[model samples]
Structures are given as structure tokens and as C-alpha cells.
Target: MRTPLPKDKCVAAAPLCQSDGEIAIIAEFLPRRIELTRADPGCISFEVKPTGDPRVWDVCECFQDAGSFELHQGRVASSEWGRATAGITRSYSVAGL
Candidate 1:
């Protein structure tokens, strides 16, 4: 995603992405992360949906812009919360990223 210029403000749309995968744990782990990510700056929307298969999950995320998405990734990579939480979960994509 790229920032739109003043003149390009009328362009198509913003950056919205989604992912589908399975997490290793549920308990309070996944919900807690969702709460924190939703409160993050530039996060337009962040949520996870169960696909009824118990092990299947769908995640949707919308950011204010590209910068926000990058920031979120950074936090996920370096934050203590991220490290601890990540250690308990295994995200299986099966195919895509």
C-alpha cells in the first residue's frame, strides 16, 4: 500500500487484507491479541472468525494506511507481548501467506 498524494485523494481505495489459518491455541491467548490489535493506532478493523472446523480460522484486518500496517508488523516482530504470545501459537497457512 502507498500513501495517496493530495491530488490522488480521489483514487480507488485503501488497503485491506485478510488471512486464513489455524492457531495452535485458543483459550485466552487469541482473544487477548485481538483486543490489543484492535486498539492499535491506524487499525481500522481487526478480528478473527471461526470457520466451524475447530482448527480453521479466518482473520480480517484493515489499516488506515500502509504505514499503519508496517507499524503493526514491527510490533508483532519486536514487542514482548508478541514474543510471548507467538511462542504459544502456530499459524498454519497450508498454502498462502
Candidate 2:
């Protein structure tokens, strides 16, 4: 059985991108982004995968806590990936934060 995550100790989100240009941007930057995020000490898990729709991706990530998640956000905000995908639409939700 899996252990339950500590309440308010984890930050999770799901962001979706829909558009050919957005998809291409993801293809270019996501690999490196995933690599960097996964290496972060506060990252519990990070996964971004293409959905059944060719232009859509499923983005799921979990951080050790809200602070970690905010740190990740700040890092991304100044990164190449952030600039490239700035205008793409995303619907995100958070839990345990």
C-alpha cells in the first residue's frame, strides 16, 4: 500500500496546453525542464506527458511543499521555457498547499 501524503506538505498541479505551437514549445523545452525539476531536492515527483490529443499534454507535478513549488515557479518564470510558453493557455489546480 502507498503511504498517504502529509496534508499541506505537498503541492500538486495539472496544467494543460492546447495548440500546435504550444505543443512544439513543450517538445523543445520540456525534456530539459523535466530533467532540472526532477533533480531539485524539493521535488516529490514531476511528470509531463502527451495526451491522446496530439496537441495536448498532461502536466502533473508535486513538490515537497508550497515553498518548494513557489521556488520552482520563480525558477521557471526566468527560464527559457517560461519565455517560450508564456502565452499558452493553461488550467491549473493545486492540492496540499
Q: Specify the highest-TM-score model's number.
A: 2
What 10-residue stretch in candidate 1 is worst by lDDT? 8-17
Model 1, span 1-97: residue lDDT tens: 5543232221121112122222444433666767877887877666577665665456666666667666877876675546645534444321111
- TM-scores for all candidates: the values are 0.57, 0.79
Q: What is the C-alpha lDDT of each candidate?
A: 0.53, 0.72
Candidate 2, residue 37: CA error in Å? 1.1
**Model 2 per-residue lDDT tens digits across residues 1-97:** 3343464434433345666777788788889989988887578788777678766666677777667778889998888978988887776767767
Q: In candidate 1, which residue ranges exceed 4 Å CA deviation? A: 1-24, 84-97
